[model samples]
Target chain A: MGDLFTDTIVISVLAATIRIATPLILAALGELIAERAGILNLGVEGTMLMAAFAAFIGAYATGSTLMALLLAVLAGMAMSFIMVFMAATLKVEQVVTGLALNLLAAGMSLYLYKAFFAVEGQAMPTVAVMPVAPIPFLSEIPYIGPILFTQKVLTYVALLMVPVVWFFLYRTKYGLEIRCLGENPKAIDTKGMSVSLRQYGAVMAGGALCGLAGAFVTIGSSARFVPDITNGRGWLALVIVIAANWRPSGILIAALVFAFLDALQLQIQGIGVQMPYQIFLALPYVLAIVLMVLKSRRGRSEEPARLGVPYFRGER
Target chain B: MGLRLEPRLAPSARWQAVSVAVALLAALAVSALLLESAGTDVGVAFAAILDGAFGGLRTTAKTLAKATPMILTGLAITVAFRAKVWNIGAEGQLFAGAMASYWLYTLTGPALGMALLPLLFAAGFVGGGLYGGLAGWLRSAFRVNEVLTTVMLNYVILYLLSFLLVGPWRDQSSFYQQSERIDRAAWLPDLWAPGKLHLGFLVAILAAVAIHVVMNRSWFGYEVKAVGLNARAARFKGINVERTAVAVMVLSGGLAGLAGMIQVFGVNHRLESDISLGFGFTGIIIAVLAMLRPGWVVFVAILFGGFENGGIKMQVATGAPSAIVSAIEAITLLFFLTAAALTRFRIVWRST
Candidate 1:
């Protein structure tokens, strides 16, 4: 226990925390936008899975990390269109549609992976990881720089996206419109704006970010794609968005905390702790529920007023 | 000339059936594209799936055995969904029930003999009900969103199951991450000799019928449907919305729990991590496809069960991935959902 708190160990844990949180932050930020716009796209998990598989296939085929990322983003956007059509146009139940999409994505990804990469007893093929782009002088700075400055280009972008999303949501006019859409799409419709169009844009952006998040799991962390690679990261992002009270800054903190627990689990396993690893694995989810319950009890519901409600132009 | 959509006052039963057919056809079309891309002949692959699902008595038994849990879970979803309670933790509830029954059977099977079987079912129902009722309580008491809570509970329960499998309840004799097989007297009686078919399938059918009666004929069912259709109105009419919500969830959960126990006693005969492969999640699809009708749920579950059992054969015959069945199920649900929405509005041709 004493040796576990060593400086090197501390820095490595912090680094792992950041590395693990990168995908959540990216996906949460996207979810932040959609949630703000009042569309609960529960299909984030499915979208990410689809994108992750697509990214892996692209990277495996082209050996170019950039191309792989591009394909992932496109795949995510494509999946999001389904949500837009279902929840936005068809006025279907957002939760069920999202669940359906998740199932579709999960099954499709496994099918595609098996069709393209099934080799009996052979390890999954690997792809070239995105090269780390460490800021030269900043990376040299002791604890902070090594942990923050030295990461893959995607990680840096994901970090940078926090502020970018914050600015877009709070500062920009279009961002204001998106927020208004969530709280009161009727008001937006009264303003002669196309509520569906704004929702489409928000969900598409969220989808792309989730796709990038998925790609990072395969390319930024692991070198190969695996089945259900996103695991429950997308779901975690949904919880983070809610726990954060729909605030961008809050999402950053929630993602980091969840990631810290994730990293801690791995470290404890490394230290050969006697406790079952499943307990540690289950910690983050349990904590999220506790946090959500507490947040809800506080009587300050920050949920979008129109969240999960379909917009039909003339419906009362 | 232009086409327009006119909002319908109410959806007709004929249109509802037609929509389902259209959704299935559309899903099949999409599957054909996927199969072709995967290098499997679509016709041959589907034929293989069909043959595998209904080829002979043996295969038909397998399909019914597979459908048992699905039918039970689907009824669980149907009950909760009809009442407007989104109990998405059916999968977790199933596991909780299985864990409860397994623990009870292991504890009392030797000492209590055949009496332990009913006790196992009761324990499973109680375990699953309590687990589900927790979420329902949170939602009704604290206004917590059941969607997130249910989904979160799923992971938590899954981890708990994993922990038990690896730690205390692990089979000591076998290296597998499973528990010791239940006592012979604790096992569900077999319905067919030389086959795995058991009385659990009959139980599923009976459960569906019971659910149908409860949903359509009972006052409790009336309250549930009332709350689902309009909670505020139901409350104004002096219905205890909170109590109804909690009761519906418990019932739904109990059904799901019973499914888990049945799978254990009727099929696996031991607790294992992979005892269920998303039966709870598939229940959602089944419930939706059946339009939340218990009787329809039975037919749909059987259809899905055939697909599930046949998927293995399709995989072996055409070398197509078995996951395609899952994809097809999802696609069909999506199409059905879209068509359901379409029923609310009529397609009309108009001159511009």
Candidate 2:
């Protein structure tokens, strides 16, 4: 009985860990694509915020999780189009443009919320949360079944996208072009391919993924929109991209590790740990910083050569 | 068979001006679509913004008041940027400065320190500079990127402040969770009777002039700008690039810190979460719009400040959410960045 109880608790925690990591994994994957394309979109935060809002609004209006997710993805792609215009077409500093987009996302979303729902202190109705479905035979198994198999459709998509992204990035021609441009835009430019077009494509891909991640927050997780709800997760996603060194597979592992840490915080709080909740709230960020420092110290830092600079074809 | 076009070294000012106009129109068009979808008139919404910002003398003064700290934060970014030292952690440093000022006032507010507002301000300046210098030292010594260090330090400082405020520093009497209010002696005097505009406005103007002189006329300023333009080239000319970087960051952090002190003394009069209101981030926008020039920062800062100040009034009156103003700000920053980029580099499309 004792062994069974301990096994159950561990499995349960791992299941919770997967649930928490899903959004981060999705968002980080998007960031990986953007960074791999040599455009560091700092506006991931804004993109996520807008996605979250769009997801909530869609879910609330249509009452269909699928529709909400779709709208959220479109909203995210739209946001990325702005980055495309700024970084790819106009050749602005991608980092600054991304940062501005984030600010714009937050401000615009909040304004829309206020303009519509400016009730003094009334709460808005929450939409239906994402439904969980368990795999037929696997879910019936004692410990391993529910932990791995039973989750929202989005979770499965997130896990599946990991290998899909890996395959696309490594085996595909378009992915090769992206990697080539990131490594040396001048070389890619010489190949008679428009470096700008490839970059715009990559950023849009990332933006769509980020939108999915944001929709997950509203429809899949909370089923309600809150102002500034994206908080700093978008930034965290950026850090995860770096910590994973722009590897899609590594992004999966990093996302799980960070999510486990986040889950641990909640478990500790649930079990009445003596420490302050604020410390736990800050633990994930602290961990990311420590991981970055450790990774940098070990000289295992793998950064693309010309990551943040705009490519002006003739300039050296 | 195709003629290749030579890339221009510099984009014409005409492109920049047009880009700015295009960006604004784009932002407005996007915002209008959002409003239309929500079933609101775009005209009424924008009019509300203009009126809230400049409808009255009281509002204009309020706008200047809002712009006050922006001048300092804008200068902080402009200085470090000119030296090519990315100091995104000004928000963290600003928090540290406010905390330091709070500490000073807490210790001296009720006692002999009643006559020491100037001393307290000095302490605030030193505190912000030191915090900024910490990131600088880490980068210069360890070759750690300032971007990462500054970003990390922001979280660390935020947590530290949270720990202090929620635990040891919590005000005992108030319903609102914040630090103990400083004695009246440490409080900044309002410049006018009705408006909340304080002595901080004058200080912002004076600092702008000081920065103008230091950036344009002074050798130190020239050295900083030279390093920004080309670090290796500046080093070739016998300039101590590292020292200049450190000095500019320290000065930059100090100015940001002073903005925090002004908030604590002038507006809030107590340390709270809303003390800086993301002024540090907004300063980046202000600096960009001003084209990183100290003189231009003044005009840009006031415009942004006016919008923010008026934004609050608009929020109160039209019930238009304050986030609308922030959206405008975000759009404005995006536009300015794009404009700057277009001015610096323009691509001519010709099929080769």
Candidate 3:
């Protein structure tokens, strides 16, 4: 137990916490944008899976990390277009559409992976992972530097996205329109702005970000892609979006907290704790539920009123 | 010319059938493209799937056996969905039921003899019902979104199952993470010799029929449908909305639990973490495909069951991944949804 609290272990855990939160932070920020625009893209999980596979394939084939990331973003955007068509244009039930898209993504990813990548009796393919780039003077600091200043470029981008997304959602004119679209699409339509177009923009942006998150899971963290590699991170991002109450800053906090729990679980396992590791693994989910319940008990959630409702022109 | 969508007063049943057929053809066409991209001969692959699903009595039995749990879960989802309750935690409830039934069977099977079977089913149902009821209660009391809670609970339940399989329930004789097999007396007897098909299939069919009657004929079913259509309207009609929601959830959970129990006793004979293979999730697709109709759920479940069994054969025959079937299912669902939407709004070209 005493060994668990060592300085080295503490620093490593903190670093791991941030590292673990990177993909979630990226995904949640994207979800934040979409949800703010009154669109619930439950297809995030499927989108992530598809992007992850695309990125892995790109990286494996080209040996260029940039190419891989680009492919992932494109894959994510392409998948989001489907959601945009269904949720925004066709006016299908968002929940079921999202669920179906998830199944589609899962199946497509597995099929593509096996078809293109799998070679019998060979080890899983690996790539030259994205290199970690530490900030110049900040890296020289004792403990804080290693934990904060040193990370992959993608991690820094994810961190930077919090403030960027916050500004975009709260400060910009377009952001105001997006928020209003969620609360009342009729108002946006009355204003002579295209509700579906704005929604399409938000969903595409969100999808690209989720794709980046998926890419990070493979290229930013692990080298090789495994089947279902994103593995519920997309769902976790959805939970974080809700838990954060749709605030960009709140998303960062929630992601970090969830990541901290995950990191703690890893550390506990490292310390050779007698208890089963699955308990620690399940802690974050349990905590998320409790937090949601507690938050709900306070009052009605600040969920967008028109969220998940399809808008039709001239509909009473 | 501009495209205009005119709202239909009421979509005809004939139109609904035509739309579904169109959607199915589109899905198949898209699936063929996917198969081509995967480098498999689409015709050969589909033929293999057909052969695998219905080539002989053995394969047909395998498909039915696979369909048993799906039919049960489909009925469960149909019940909950009819009440407008999105009980996505059927997966978790299923694990809970299987665990409870397995625990009961291991404890009382030797002493209770044949009576243990009934007890196991009851235990499984009660276990799942309680788990699902928790979500319903939370939703009713706090207006919590059942979707999020149920999805979260799935992971929690999965971990709990993992803990049991790895810790207390671990069979010492095997290296695999699975519980000890129950006594022979506790096993669900097979209906046919030389085949794995068991009484569970019949039980599922009977349950589906019973649910159909209850859904279509019973007062409770009417109340549930009323609540689903409009809670405020149902409240004005003197129906207890919250109570119905909770009751629906319980029944849904119980049915899902039965699916788990059947899988354990009739197929696995031991509690393993991977026993379900996402049967609970697939049940959602089946229920939706059936358009929330109880009778249609049986047919849809069989269709999906064929896909599951056929997928493996397709994989073996063409070296194409069985995941294509899942992709196909999703495509079908997307098309079905679009078709449903089309039924409400007919396209018209207006000259500007």
Interface RMSD of candidate 2, in Å, is 2.0
In Å, candidate 1's interface RMSD is 1.0
Q: lDDT (CA) for every model shown?
A: 0.89, 0.81, 0.88
Query: Candidate 2's fnat?
Result: 0.62
DockQ of each: 0.80, 0.54, 0.76
| Candidate 3 clashes between residue pairs 3 or more apart in a chain or in different chains | none
Q: lDDT score, residue A261, model 3?
A: 94
Q: Tens digit of lDDT per residue, candidate 3, span A156-186?
A: 9999999999998889999999999899889
Tens-digit per-residue lDDT, B170-266, candidate 2: 9888777688877776777778848688988888788889999999999999999899899999999999877787788789888988899999888
The sequence of per-residue lDDT tens digits that candidate 2 reaches over residues A120-197 is 788876889999989889888877778879888889999999998888888999988888777899988998988988
**Candidate 3 error regions (>4 Å):** A1-5
Q: Residue B217 in model 3: shift from native, Å? A: 1.5
User: Which DockQ-derived CAPRI band holds candidate 1?
Assistant: medium
On lDDT, the stronger of 1 and 2 is 1
Total backbone collisions for each predicted model: 0, 1, 0
Better of 2 and 3 by lDDT: 3
lDDT of 1 by residue, B172-196 (tens): 9998888887777778888995557
In candidate 2 the C-alpha lDDT for residue B223 amounts to 98
